[model samples]
Structures are given as C-alpha cells and as structure tokens.
Target chain A: MLDFLSEFPSLGRRDLSALRQWIDEGFRTFSRAYGEQLEAFFNPLLRFLVWFQDLLTDAPWPLVILAIAALTWFGARSWKITGGTIVAFLLIGIFDMWEDTMATLAMISVATVLCIAIGIPLGILMARWDRAQSVITPILDVMQTIPSFVYLIPVVMLLGIGKVPGLLAVCIYAIPPIVRLTNLGIRLVDREVMEAAEAFGASYRQKLWGVQIPLALPNIFAGVNQTIMMALSMVVIASMIGVQGLGVPVLRAISNQYLALGLMNGLAIVALAIIFDRVSQTYGKRLQAYRETGRD
Target chain B: MTEEEPKVRIKSLYKIFGDTPKVALSHVQAGMSKSELLEQKGHVLGLRDINLDIPGRKIQVIMGLSGSGKSTLIRHLNRLIEPTSGEIWVDGEDVLAMNDKALRDLRRFRMSMVFQKFGLLPHRTVQENVEYGLGIQDVDQGEAAERAKKWIDRVGLAGFEGHYPGQLSGGMQQRVGLARALATDAEILLMDEAFSALDPLIRTDMQTILLELQEELHKTIIFITHDLDEALRIGDRIAILRDGEIIQASDPQDILMNPADAYITDFIKDVNRAKVVRMRSIMGPAAPAQGAPVAVSDTIEEALQKLHAAPDGCCPVMAGDEIRGTVGIDAAIQALKAPAAAGAHYS
Candidate 1:
C-alpha cells in the first residue's frame, strides 16, 4: 500500500523547483519594470525622513536630551520617568554613542509616525468595510509572520540598499500591529455609544472623529508603543544594509569580538526601549484609568 | 386636555431581519408567527405590521417585554433602523423619504433621544455630553454652553457638570442623559427605556421628573418601556406589543377596565385598577348629592376617600366645578370590586 501511494508521481516525488523558478523570474521582471516608478513615488517621504534624521542628529546633544526628557514628563506625568529618560540618554552620551542613538531615534520616529499615518486609516477602513478587512487581513498576516529580514530583500532590491531601504524595511515590519490594533479598537467601540451617536444625527465624519476615535485612543496608543518597539528591534538588522545607528557598534563588536563595546551599545538600546515603553504604557494606562474610574 | 395633532405617524410599518427580508415579509403578513418565520426561512420577524399615531405634545408609551419590538418601533421614528416597508411622518413631513442631509437636520433640529444605558460619552464631562447635540447642530459655542448649563441645572445636575458618567450613579447618569436630550430642545423626544436601568425608587423619581418637565414643556414624547407601572404612570396613550404585533392600544383606563383580548386581560389582571380608573367611569346620572363634589379626573381611590366624609355617602363628579354626574356609594363600591384593586396596596 505504501509503495502504491509513493508511486503517485505528483505526491511524495513532486518537486516545487519549477514553480519557484517561475515565481522568481516573474518577480524579477515585474520589479525591473516597475521598481523605478515605485521608488519615485516614495522619494519625497524618504527625503523628509533623511532631513528629519539629520536635523535631530545635528542638534546639540544637551538640547535633544532636554527635549526628550521633557516630552517623557509631559506624557508620563511622572518625575521618576522624566529622570529615567535623562539618565538613559546620558548613558548613551557617556558611551560616546550619542549621535548613533539620535540616528536610531530618528529612524524609529520616522517609521512609527509613517506607520501610524498610513496604518490607522487603513485600519479604520477595515473596521468600516468587511470587504476591506477581508482583503487586508491575509496581507497583514503574511507581513507579520514572515521573518523580519525577508522584508529587507525586496526593499533593498527595489531601492538599492541605503537609509531609505532600511527605513522602508523597518516600516513594513512595524506597521501590521498598529493596523490590526486600530481596527480592533474601532470595532470594539461600544455599540450603544455608536447608536447614541447615530441617534443624535452625527455624520460619518462626526462619528469617526467625535466618538470612535476618542474611545479608541488607548488602544491606538498601545499600537503606537508596539510599533516603536518593533522599529527599534530592527535597528541592528537594518545596520546590515548600511543605515548608521547604535546597531553599527554592536555589529562591529560582533565581528571584532569586542565584548565591552557590544555590551555597552546593547545596554543603550535596551535603555531606549525601556524609556519608550514606560512613557507610552503610562499614557495608555492613564486613559484606561479615566475610562474605568473617572479620574485622570 | 386640548386635542393635539399627531406629531409622529407610523403607517403599516414592517421590519424583517435577514439577507432578503422582502421575500420573507409575505409569509409574515400572511400570519406566520415569529418563530415560524425564524424556523422556516432563517429570517427574524422583528416587527409585524405596526400602525400608530403618536400625538403631538403628549407622551406615547410603547410597552412590551424583551423581543417585543418596542425598541425597534422607537428607532423607526428617527429612521435609525430602516423599515422593510413603511411610511413614517414626523411633524407632517415624510421622514422615510428624507435625504441624508434632511434626515440629519431632522435629528439635529426635530428630535433628541435618551437611552436606556445612559450612553453618555465616557471621554467627555457631563457638561460636554449635554453640549453634544448643540454642537452637532452648529449652535454658537457660547449659546450652546449656556443652554447646556441651563438643562444641566434643570435636570438637577448643577454642580456635577465637570464629572464624568463613570463618577455618577445610575440615576444620576440618567439625569445627565435627560439633560443632554433636553439641551437640544428638539420638539420630539424619544426615550427608549430611559429609566429601566435604575432601581425602583430611582425609576419612580425619574418618572416624576419627566412628568414635571412634560407639564411645562409639552414636547412630543415617545417613550419605550417594559415596565407596566411606568407605562401607566407616564403614558397619556399606551400601545402594548407582544411578539412583534400590537395587541391593544388605548388610554390607561380603557386598557385597565376592558382589555381587548385574553393576552391583554391577563396583562392587566395583576394591575391595581383603582389608581388607574377615573371617577367618570363609574359615575351615575347627575343627581342632587350631599358633600363637596369630587373631580372627574380623580382616580377611583380619591373618589372613595372623598366619599368617606360625605354626609349622604354621595358626591357629584365635577369637571372644573361643572357637575357631570353624581357618584354614590353603590358606584364607588362597584368600582372597588375590580379584581386587582380589592386588597392590593396603592403603591
């Protein structure tokens, strides 16, 4: 019986080599035809990202540290958080990696902002239309489940390996969580509240802005936090494509077997992650607490 | 009372829920039961042919248990739930045919709703929640704020304007809901189980507050409730629904005294009729009687109390001091013989 089953040529003996070759050839031709146009479409955004990164890195280290610490204070509303943020930034500076840290922050900021700007509307559309959700879901699933490095390959092939390709890879890797969470957030809005809004004659725009978005804020903020963390995690991988950041030190240390340098830079990355996490988590918790207990 | 025109008229309204309700509607109209429709075609008969004329400047209460389509009927007034086939007229304008802009205008300018769940926006203060309808109407912010404050105070939430709905008790949150609806000053108010979420005592207090407000405002109010007592207390006219069909619709006394069918009869079997039936129902032909007359509007309970001190155990049933008829001990005793009134506590 086993021999008979194995004798079916298309079963165990079947090979996917031909299908793989066709897919590879098709992708290569498609990219050769449309790659330039795609890059042209994204050029302005890439330029803006580069300009923003340069502006931040060129700013005085003390001023940048002061501003970040102040922003953390504003969001977290905690002296402890503000102090921690200052200490974290100062540690990066002490390790002679202040510029690299700023570069990484710039990359994460640009990627996170773009992700939110693009992801939230798509998510809202998904929430509003079943068709859009169905169409986008499988795409999001693929984007999230694939190895993060896989994103860099096509991006590099199309844009040809630089800060732009690296940033694009980071964005592709980080966007799905925000989109999924945003859709979930909007869908989770209280049905009674939406009915009340509709009953009160709220227009589509009014309902979206006044009711759904306000209630979805905590969840959306959580998504942003996750996106930022994901973007940061991609820093070292992004360095493989020549985007200069704190990850460069780590990569250099790996090849040179320099333990102290790798450990210091790695700790700096962790510090940045902790600072971003605490600030965003605190802000999200405040919103949730207000919803639960009427205290803000 | 003055004879008011109908503010909201629903003509032959039907709502069927499914992928294709128009196909299922024929079976429903041909007397298929709700369960039969659900079982046979996978379509839920949300409402059967419902016809009603809600009078202007009066409270029209639609009462039923859950799944009776009372809430669905109220939603149809605002066109929140589109009917499978029907016509709804609000203020003599065809609401069903209004375009989106006109419908929005109708909602913003003509009607406001109070919800059973309060539905206060959690992110906003009580004051902001009250200001919502005005904001949607594009009222000037200052004027909107002034009006919102007035209604907030009128609903007896003067100092809690800054508090959120989460900070308030159920009754207090409903007051905020009341304030929000009233702040819009929409001529027609749709209250869907507005007090059903409150405790019994709080619900009674809310009913009193509504009646008092209605006395002064005289806004056209369509209220939905499952509680019979609340319906009787607040409704000038009542419509009772069962399984998506109207069993009977009449004044409180008519409903209590002569139920239209067995279902309605069983419904009123537990009701205290003395408090609902008026002196006019049991009064005899006009005749010379002993003591000060009791008003025709007085409940039978009041007439009995008035007869207690009457010299001849008789009194005139007076409408504004014009004697309509006389009520003696015989008629009073007969009225008291109502099945549920004999030993039931008035409260």
Candidate 2:
C-alpha cells in the first residue's frame, strides 16, 4: 500500500508553474482594468469614514460622554448598563487611548455599514434562489475558513497598502456572519405564515418588506453584532497595511516587544468589544421579546 | 345547485406531487396505489379526480382525517396549491384560467382565508393583522382601519387590538384571523381548521361565534375539519374525503342517517346521533292529524324533547312554519339509537 501510494504520487508534485503564472497574469490584468473604478466607488465611503472620525474626536469630551451614555441607555435600557458604558469610556480616557479608540470606532463603523449594505441583499438572494445559494455558499465558506491575514495579500495586490485596502480587507473578513445569519433568518420563517401571506394575495415585494424582513430583524441584528465584533478583531491585523487606530499602538508594541503598551491596547480593544457586545445583544433580545410575548 | 348556481365548482381535479406529476397521474388513473406510486415513481397522489359544487352563501364543510386531502382540496379553490390538472370555477368565472394578477385580485377582493395555526403576523398588532386583507385590497387607510375595528369588535376582541398575536391566547389569535378574513368583505370565506388549535371550550365558543356570524353574513364558507360533530353542526352540505378522494358528498343528516360506505360509516360511528340526526330525517309522510309542530331543521334530540311535551307522543315537522311531515316518538327514539361499529379501521 505504501509503495502504491508513492507510485500515485502527491498532488503538489504535479502543479504546473506555467498554470500558476497564467492565473497570476490574468488576475493582474483584471485588477488593472477594474482597480480605478473600484477605488472611485469606494471614495464616498472613505470620505464618510474620515468625516465620522473627525466628528467623534473633535466633539467636546463631556458632550461625547453624555451622548454615549444616552445611546447606551437606549440600547441596554438599564441604568447599570449606561453606567458601565460610561466607565468603559472613562477607562479609555485614563489609558490615554481616546483618539486611537475613535479611529478604531470609525473604521469599524464604516466596515459594518458596508458589510450590511452588501451582505443583506446577497443573503436575501440566497434565500430566494437555490442557484444563488449554491454559488455563494462555497465562497462564503472560503472567506470564513481562510486566515484573516491571507486576505491582506490580495487586498495589497489590488488596492495597495492604505486605510482603504485595510478597510476592504476587514470588510471581507467580517461580512460572512451577517450574510449567513440573514439567509438563516429568512429561511427559518414559518412556512405556514408564508403560505398565509400568499393566500391573502400579498405581492412578492410586499411579502418581503412587510413580513419576511420584520420577522427576520432579530436574527439580522444578531448578524450585525457579530460583524461589528469581527471587524474589531481585524483591527491590529488591519493596521499592518497602515490603517491607524488603537491597532497602531498594538502593532508598535508587538514590533518593539513592549509588554505594557501591548497589554494596555489589548485591554482597550476588549473593553470596546464588551460595550458594543452588551448594547447590541440587549437590543436584539428586546426585539425578540417584543416579537414573541406569550412565551414568557 | 337548487335555486341558485354554486359559488364554487370544481371538476376532474387531480393533484400529484413531484416534478413528473403528469406521468405519475397516468399511473394513478390506471389504478396504482398511493404507496406503490410513491415507492416506484417517487410521486404522491395528493388529490384524485375530485368533483364538487359548493353552494353559494352556505357553509360547505369538508371533513377528513389528516392526509385525507381535505386541506389540499380547499387550498385548490384559492389556487394556493396549483392542481396537476383541474378546472375550478368561482362565481361562474374560470379560476384555473386566471392570470397571476387576476388570481391576486380574486384572493384580495373575492375570497379570504382563515388558517389553522392562526397565521397572524407576529410583528404586527392584532388590529394590523385584522386589517391585512383590507390593506392588500388597497382600501383607504381610514376606511380599512374602521372596517378592521368593526370586525375585531364582532369577533369579541375589541380591547385586544393593541396586543400582538404572540401576546394573545390561541383563541384570541384565531379571532384575529377571523376578523382578518371578515374585514375583506369577501363573498367566500375559506377556513382551514381555524379552530383546531384552541382548547375544547374555546373551540365551541368559536364555533358559536362563526355560526352566529354566518346567520347574519351568509358568506359562502368552506370549513375544513376532522371533527364529525363540528361538520354536522355547521355544515349545510358536508363532503367527506379519504386518501385524496371524495368518499361522499351530501347533507349532514343524510351522512348521519345513511353513510355512503364503510369508511364514512366508521367516521360517524362514534358521533352523537341525537345531536346530528334531524327531525326531517326521521319524519314519515305528512299526516292529516297533528298535534304540536317542530321545525324540519330541528335535531332528533330537540324533536324528542318536543314529542315528550305532546300528549299523543307525535309532532309534525314544519319547514318554516308549514307542516311537511310528522315524526312519531317511536321513530325519533329509533333514530336516536347509535349504530353498531361494523368496519375495520383503515390504516
């Protein structure tokens, strides 16, 4: 059996260098053709991110803290949660991580919005058509299973090293959860309910907007939460391509082997994650409770 | 079919489930068994050559056990389940020939349905759920709200309008389902086991509500149920289905007095005869001599109660105050006796 295995040989030994060269050449040509237009398309989004960052950092610290407290109160709907959110923000201030945190926040916000804008419709398409599901499912699997660092190579090749490339790479890494959740949510809607809608003669558009989306909101929000978390996780990795944030300090600490700086930045990231996580998860739970009241 | 044309007419309806249904239909028509068709051809015979005429403004009850295609047959009337091959006529218009838009129009304006599980939109309030049909029909916002509110009140769910379906009890949710259907003001109302999810007491209350509303509205209702008693109580004409075929179609009194075959006989064996059997069914030819009078529509139990009050132990059966025939105490008592169970249970 061992002799026969050697006789069959390994798949790696059969690779053609010419085939690899041709594929790389083809990709380069395609990238050359589409790169400028893609960058132009992303210009508005990039501008929005810059504007958001300025807004967050330029505001008076007291007003920004008050606004954060208000948003926290709205999202978690508890005084304890609002107090926790304020403490988390105050810790960033004490650590002197405020400006870097704002940059990370802006980058994550842009990446999340982009993911939702792209992921939801694609997810709906997957739910609507078997063919679309079949086509996109494998791609999503690859995106999720591959190492996040591996995406940087492709992003560098296409758009080069910058905040835009870093943002795109983070979005690519973060989008799968929202897409998968959206598709699952729509598919999970009760079949009898869908039939009832059809029997009542609802148009396809009406059925989608009126029934499906509203029912799927809780799941979709869960997806958004997961996307935001994933985007935040990509922070330090994204900083490798010159995206500035708390990740920059983390990257600097890593290169210099500075323990205090690395630990402080890492803890700041965890703090941000906890605040975002609590608010979003609480809101999602509230929506689910609102939808299913008799259960309790 | 008597004085007025039927509100719905179905002819030669055949529904087979599979991609190659036409091929499977041929095998089914050629007398292949349902299991044999499934095993050999991978297709299920959902409905077989069903013919029925549902009279206008009368409650036409379709009763059968689960998988008997009773639900399947009713769904065909609304084109919710497209038949493999069939003709459906609603109000003398060919339903099968209608395009998608026309079919939508038919569902929106001419027919409404109540679902078994109370298919209320969980995200919507009860008022919004009740208003769904009217909204779909493009009724004006204010007018639709008014009509929905009225039906909601009629269904005895006046204060629950602000509540969600998930917040309401099953019976209340079903009332919202009823209100939704009624608010459309559609001529035909199709209720597919609309009360099956409720508790027994609530189910009876819903039945009373439906019957009382039917008295006033007179909408052509096609009610599907597995309960024989419910069928007898509400149905003007009852059609029994088994294995995707109509076993019998007749008046409820006829079904109770003379079941078509062993299958239908078995279905009605456990039924309370005094409650189901009517005076008209037990009455003999009209006699010149009569004492008290009972309505022809009166049940055997009522007729017996009436006969007990009569000194001679006999009462004339009246059809709207006109004497048609007389039912004796002996005949009413005889009809009240339950028939012996004589058939093996079908698998």
Candidate 3:
C-alpha cells in the first residue's frame, strides 16, 4: 500500500507510447487519403496569392507608392498619414527590402480578407443563436490558446510546407479576434433600436444589412485591425514552413546570428503595422462621428 | 359615442412572461394573482384578460404607471409582444393568425410605431431616417425621399434633414420619430410613450403637434402614457391599468366623475380636476341661463373664467348650435372641489 501510494497508479509508458503512435498513424492515413483533394480545393487561393504577389512586385515602385498613398488618403483622409506611408515605403525600398515587403503585404491582405469573409458570418451566427455561440466559443478558445507550432505540425503534414499551409496557419492564428469582436459588436447594439427596426417590418436580411451591419461597422473594423496585426506577427513563423516574405530573411538572420538583418526586417514589419493600425482606426472613428458630436 | 365599428379589437388577451409560459399561463387563468404567480412560478404576468375596442379616427390612451403593462398591451396590437393566449382583430382581420410574411406586411403597410426613446438610426440623417419606413416597403427611392421630405417639413424639421439624431435635442429626435412613423402612410399609428422622454415643456409642445396632426389626418392612433394630465389632454378614451389589469376604461370625464376603484382614485388624486372636468359633465339638463354661452366641450376652468366675467354666475352649455344644458357657479365650484375618493357622488 505504501509503495502504491508513493508511485501513484497511472498508464504505463509503453501504453502511452502505443496510444500516441496509434493517433499518429490514424492522422497520417487520413492525410494520405485526402491530401490531394484538399490541395485541389485550395488551388484557387494559391493562384490568387501568387498573382497578387506578382502584381505588387512587377508594378513600378512609383506607381505602387502612389496607389498606397491614395488608398491611405481615401481611408484616413489625413495628409499626415498618407505622407508617412509614402515615406515608409520609400525607406523600405531604399533598404532593398521592397520585394519581400510586397510579398508580406500581399499575404497580410489576403489573410485579412479571408478572415473577414469567414469570421463575420460565423460571428453573426453566434450572435443570433446561443447554441452556436456555446459550441464555437470553445473551439475559438482552443485555436487562440494553443501554441502556433502545435497546429503547424499537422498543417505541414497535410499540405507539406507551402504557401497554402502557411496561409492557413496565419488565418487560424488571426481569426479569433474578428469573430469575437463581431459577435460582441452586434450583441452590444441597443435593444430598443433593434425592436424599432422589427416594428418597422424590417425582414431579417433588411435588418442585417441596413441596421445591424451599419451599426456594427466600427466594431467590425476594430476586428479587422486586430486581424491584420496578428497576421503580420505570424509572418516569421509562417516563413518557417517555406513561405516567402521579409520573414524569410528574418528567419535567416535568427539561424545565422546576424543582428542587423533581423532588425531591418523587424522594423519594416513594425512600420507596416503602424500604417495599417492608424488608417483603420481613423476610418472606424469616422464611422461613429455621430456618436461623438451628440449632447446626450 | 357613435355606433361605428371599432378599428382595432382586442379580446381576452393574456401575456405570461417566462421560459415555461404555457404552464404559468394556466395558473394565471385560474385566478392566480400577479405577485403570487411571480413568487411561486417565477413568471411575470404582463397583461391579463384585456378586452378593448378602439374606435377609428380617435386617440385611444392606455395609461398606467411603470410596470403596469401599458406598454406591453400596446405592443399586442402590432404583435410586438405575442400574447400567451388571446385574439387581436384589426379591421375585422385576425392579427394573431398572420404568417411571417403577412405580419411583416401588416406592420409595414397598416401599422407604424413611434418609440419613447425616439429610435432613430444613429447612422442615418434625419431625412434618411424618416424615409426608412418607405424604403423598407421597396418604394421608389425618389418617391420615398419626396414623401420623407414632405413629412420632414410637416414635423418642422426641414432645415435639419441633414443632421444626425445624435446632434438633435430630445424634442427634435421625437419629431424625426414622428416623421418616420407618419412617412409610411400607414392608417394606424402606435405611439408607445412617444413624448414621455421629453421635458414637460417639450412634452406639451409635442402633444400639441400630435393633436394638430391628428386633427387633419384623422388616423387611428393608440397613445400610451403614465401621466393622467397627458391622458386627459389628448385621449378620446382612456384605459387605466394597474398590476397588469385594467382598473377602469372610459371617457376622461367619466373616469374623473366616477373612478372604478380605490387604485384609480389614488392615480387621479393629485390631478387638477378644474382642467379636465368639462362643462358637459357638470351641466344641468337643457335649460335657459342668463350669462354668455360656453361650449359643452369647454373645461370647467374655461367655463368658470367666462362665467366669472359675465354679469350672471351661470352659463348655457352649447353643443354645436343648440344649448344642451346650463351650468351654475355653485355646480362648477362643487365639481372642482370634489375629492377624488368621493368621485362616485358626481355620477
């Protein structure tokens, strides 16, 4: 009895190893059977990412700079932000990081678009039904709290270290904020306001598009901003699995102990993040301009 | 007073609020009190055995304090809150039997509501907000805008059409709310404490505007309020509710002259009777009198003012072109001085 209490009863090491092996074999078999089909399903996304990256890299530097400045101006309507963005791009170009920066930008943009497209609907579903919220919330928790490398192993096993798998990993990392915020934003809409829409005979689609979506825009934009930041932060980890970006050189610097190379690429990433954050936040604030001006 | 058909009829309506409403409803139907049901079954009784027939082209006021279910009762007309069991007939059609599409159509085209909180879309400008009801019905955009502009002008909000609701005062927001509800051209206007959020001065101004609009439009209006003064001011008929049950429902003068019970008497105890008691209630049978004639519709205060200025202390109460009765100073004084607890003596 004393020996048993001291050791504690547990599964034997051989049994645990066998159980792990069994799970590993099951996943490998599953991936072997469905890998080609899954790859085919993601072909369009792969093609789109390649085309976007090529477009950014092949376009004249001046033209790209001008387009980004115009977009910044349109979104933020601030001369300071537009000027700062132009200067940042010029600096990145001077540092000979233009090609990698464009690649990273393309990846971040596509990741953001995909996350919004999927996350918003899921968030809306969660807001509308308690059961959907109950089920999805825990899944989101697992996706968020689980270490990036843990999911990377299975993702790489299935897709075998390419852009599509890397993109999937970034999306999984960045999607939770958008979904959670969208649900919260929609739920936070005034109850009386929703009732008024209902009393006016607004159908479900009408209420969603006209009232709920418009009112929730600021929150959705916040989610989008967070998603972009998270996706940018994942660039280096994503590059570990054969994705190309500034992250590639950063990874090289890390492995070779080259401090200057890592710092340059890291600063480029930080600049991009600031530009995205400011522009999106400014646009979100403008959407709620009415709220700021009212007396009571 | 005419024998015309009622525009909206509610029969034996009951509303129990809880997870298991049907079970709670059984207890309420069997004469369980509201508090008892709430304590024992954890269910709220929202409304109980409500029966009312609202006449067309008049303001029907549902009056009660907070939590008395006056708001809940008005929502039943538009089916905003579904009854636990009852039937609501609007224009002789069964409202409760409508499918989703039919219900939407009914709300979109036949009934429009103004909210107490002035539920204007914060994202929309006043013009767009007013045009919302029209837009929902898939009306042509230009025509909807035109109609919306007309109402914006009518509600005295023409110059402020571009301003957002947040920029407006409470009174102005409600004007936008009124404009939005009226823009649909629906026949029934359901105002759920529409002016209760405004200051007293703004509330009276809104009341006057509503009355002025009702005079020209002659739409069937259901107005809900807690203030007895507001009910007496605008209601063609008033129903006083207490604890989810209607204690009394009648013409304002009838309620003033003969309260149904102690609860109603308490509700009207502080009301200034001189303002609400009309000459028609205190007038004697058709008889000749010496002073200048006062309209039967005039309040006792107005009649007294005229009677005091006349050489004689009596006045003839005129109903249209004919004198229906006479009112003396002594009777007017008695009417004004009568205690609410002893209101039955007047009847």
Candidate 4:
C-alpha cells in the first residue's frame, strides 16, 4: 500500500507516449492539408502588416516623431506628457534604436487594433449570453495562462516562422485583458439606465451604440491600455519567430552576452510602454470628467 | 361628468415573479395570500387581479408604499414588464397582443415614462438626453434638437442644456428626466415615483410644475407616489394599493371621506384632513348663511381661515355664481377628525 501511494498510479509511459504521438501526427496532417488555404486567409493581414511597417520605417524620422507627438498631445491633452514623449523618442533616436523602435511600434499597434476589433465583439457576445460567457471564459483562461511557448509550437506549425505567426502569438497573449474588461464594463452598466433606454423605445442597436458603448468607454480604454502593454511585453518572444523590432536586438544581445545592446533596446521598449500607458490613462480619465465634477 | 370611454383600461391583470410564473399565478388566482405564495412556492405575487380604467387627460395617481407594485403596474401600460396574465387596452388597441413592432410604436409614439432615479444618460449632456427619445424614433437631427430645446426650456433647464446630468442637483436631474419624456410628445405620461428622490421643498416645487404643465397640456398622466399629501395635491383620481392589491380607488375627496379598508384608514390616519377635505365634501344642503360665501373648491383649511374673520360661524359654499350649500365651523371641525373605527385589526 505504501509503495502504491508513493508511486501514485498514473497513465503508463507507453500510453502517454502513444497519445502524444497521435496528437502530433493528427496536427501535422491537419496543417499539411489546410496550410495553403490558411496562408491565403492571412495574406491580406500580412500585406497590411508589411505596408504599415514600411510606412513607419520609410517615413522621414522628423515626420514620424512629429506625428507621434501630435497623437500624444491629442490623447493626453497635456503639454507635459507630449513633451516627455518627444524627449523619449529623441533619446531612442540618439541611441541609434529609432528604426527598431518604429518597427516595434508598428507591430504593437497592429496587434492591439486586431485584438480590439475581434475581442470587443466577442466580449459583447459574452455579456449578452451566459452560455457564451461560460464557454468562452475557459478558452480565454487557457489563452492567458498557458505558456507562450506551448501555443507558439502550433502557431509556428500552422503558419511557419514569419510575421503572421509572431503577430498571432502576441495577440493570443494580449487579448484576454481586453475581452474580459469589455465584458465587465458592458455588464456593469446600470440596469435602470438600460431600462430607461428601453422605456423610450430604443432598439437593440440603438441601446448598444448610444447608451451601452458610450457608458462603457472608460473601461474599454482601460482594456486597450492593458492590451498594448501585454503586446509590448511579447515583443522579444515574438522576435524569436522572425518578427523584426527592438526585440531583435534584445534577442541578439541575449545570445551574444552584449550588455549595452540589450539594455538600450529594453529601455526603448520601456519608454514606449510608459508613453502609451500615460496617454491612454489620461484620455480615459478625461472621458469621465463629468462624473468627477461637483454639482454646478 | 360627461360619459366617455377611458383612454386606458385594464382588466384581470396579474403578475407573478418567478421562473414558473404561470404555475404560481394559478395558485394566486385560487386565493393564496402574498406571503403564503412566497413562502410555499418561492414566487412573489407582484400584482393580483388589477382592474382600473384611467380617464383621458387627467392625473391618475397610484399611491403605495415601497413593494406595493405600483411601479410594476405602471410599467405594464407600456409593456416594459410583461404580465403573467392580463388584458390592457389603450385607446381601443389591445396592448398585450401587440407584436414587437407594434409594441415599439406604442412606447415610442404614445407613451413616455419618467423614472424615480432620473435615468438620464450620464455621458450625455442635458440636451442630448432630452433628444434621446426622438433620436430613437429616427427624427430629423435639426428637428429633434429644436424640439428638445423647447422642452429643456419648458422644464426650466434651458441654461443647463450643455451640462451633464452628473453635474446637476437631484431636482435638476429630474427636470432633465421630465424634459426627456415630454420631448417625445407622447400623449400618455407615466411618472414612476418621479419626485420621490428630491428633497421635500424640491418635491413640492416639482409637483407644482407638473400641475401647471397638466393644466395646459392635458396629457393623460399616471403619477406614482407613497406620500398621501402628494397624491391628494395632484391626483384627479387616486388608487391606494397594498400588498399587490388595490384596496380603494376613487376621487380624492371620496377617498379622504370614506376609506375602503382598515389599511387605507391607517394609511391616511396621520394625514391632516383639513388640508385635503374639500368644502364641497362637508357642505350641507343649499341654505342661506349669514356670512360671506366660500368657493366649493376650497379645502377645509382654507375655509376655516376664511371663517375666522366671518361674523357668523357658518358660511355659504359657492360652486360658481350660485351657492350650492353652507358649511359651519362645527361641521368643518367634524370633518377634520378621523372616521369611526371600521376594523379591529389595528390597535
């Protein structure tokens, strides 16, 4: 009895190995059959990603910096944040990491946009139905908690090592916060307010766009900020699959033991994260200014 | 009063709140009590056999304490809360039988409601909130804005149109709520405890505003309240509900003089009868009195004030140009006292 207890009965090694072999072979067959169609399905996304990266890198450096400064100013509405962002970008440029910074910025932006475009509707669906929530919540849990390398194998197997697979890997990691936050935000809308909309004969579409979505904006913006941060963190990991960015230098530095190279690229990523977080947070706060002010 | 059809009619209305409402409804119909139903079947009896006919263009007040289901009953008029069993007829159309499109039209074009919590969209300005109902109906943007502005001005919120509801006082937010409802120009206005959240002074002011608007608009209004004073002040016809059942419904003066049950008597026991009892209710047969005439419309309190200066203790009550009866100080005092005990339930 003691021996059995200590050993802990489990699947036999032969059975476990056979199960693993079966899964690997099944996945290989599926990929071999669907690989061409899957590539065609993602061609437009690939073209868009390439075009966006080219736009960021091929543009004159001054124009790019000015555009980022203007976007920061528009979002934060604060001169301090805009000035800090400008200085951060200039520092990256002076350190000769401008090209890599731009490439990473493009990648993170596209990933975030794609996540929101897909995740928000899925989140809304979850908020509408308990069945959908129960089903999707577990899948999102796996996406969020599973090791990045585990999913990387399947994604790489399906799409091969390139920008698309890397983008897919980053999105898998970054999308959960957005989807969860959006579901929470929409579900948290006041019941009385929604009833008022219905009492006035608002259609389903009207209630969503006019009342629910507007009220949920601050929370949705929070989700976006979180998604951007998670995407940025995945940059180095994503670079291992051939996606180009500041992650490339960091990866090189890791393999070659070059301290300066790793430090500069890592700091550039940190600077980018700070600028995105501050601008988005300030904008979110601005959206709820009405709630903060005292009665007139 | 001229004989005319009521604008809204309800018959055999019942509401049961639970997963198996139809089953619970059968038990309630078979005479199960409210608490008994809740205890035995885990179902709440929301309203039981509600039948009422609301006349056109009048303020019909439904008075009840919290949990009396006055809000639930009013929502049935617009079908916001579907009934377990009932028939609702508004202006000759069957409300319960309406399909989705018809119900939408009914709510959009015929009825509008003002909520107790002032459910103005917090993200929207007062102007945008007021325009919401019209926007839902697909009205022209410029036209909707102009109409919304008119109501915003009408409700005394013109200057605050650009402000968000969160930046306003409770009274101001309710004004926005009122303006939003009225801007739709729906003939039926349902006010579910619309003034209950305001301070007493603000509540009184809002009551006066509603009365003044009703005088001109003559919209068919259903007002819900827990305060007897508010019901007496504004209700053309008052219905008193308790435990999901209406114990009494009649003219305001009739309810004050002749309460239908012990619960109603207890409900009105603390009310200052002099303020609510009209001279018309207490006046005697048409007889010449040795004092100045008082308007039949005056309350007992107002008549007493007038009698204080009269040489004689009695005064003639005039309906218009002619005396309808006389009311003496003794009769006025008698009217102020509570009715004789009608039930042994209350100590």
CAPRI accuracy category, model 4: medium
lDDT string for model 4 (A114-146, tens) is 999999999899888999999999999999999
Q: Write the per-residue lDDT of candidate 3 for residues A1-296, one digit (tens) a residue.
A: 89899997999999999999999999999999999899999999999999999999999999999999999999999999999999999999999999999999999999999999999999999989999999999999999999999999999999998899999999999999999999988998888889999999999999988888889988998999999999999999999998999999999999999999999999999999999999999989988888788474
- Per-residue C-alpha lDDT of model 1 across residues B1-347, encoded as one tens digit per residue: 77666888988999999999999998888889899899999999988889998888889999999999999999999989999998899878999899999999999989999999988898899999999999999999999999999999998999998888898899999999999999888999999999999999999999999999999999999999999888989999999999888989998877877667766766777667678778887788999999678998888787787787888889988999588999887677776654443333322
- Runs in model 4 with CA error above 4 Å? A1-4, B308-312
Off by over 4 Å in 3: A3-8, B309-312, B340-347
Cα error, residue A16 of model 3, in Å, equals 1.1
A11-105, model 2: which lDDT tens digit per residue? Answer: 56337676787888998898899988888887887788888989999998778889989988899998888998899889898889999998898
Give the worst 10-residue stretch by lDDT in candidate 2 chain B: B338-347
Q: Candidate 2 vs candidate 3: which has greater lDDT?
A: 3
lDDT of 2 by residue, B178-230 (tens): 99999999999999998888899999999999999999999999999998888
Where does candidate 2 stray beyond 4 Å? Answer: A1-4, A7-16, A29-34, B306-312, B338-347
lDDT minimum window of 10 residues, candidate 3 chain A: A287-296
True contacts kept of each: 0.64, 0.64, 0.76, 0.74
By lDDT, is 1 or 4 better? 4
Q: What is the Å distance of residue A51 in model 1 from its true position?
A: 2.6
- The CA lDDT at A186 in model 4 is 94
Q: Whole-model Cα lDDT per candidate?
A: 0.88, 0.89, 0.93, 0.93
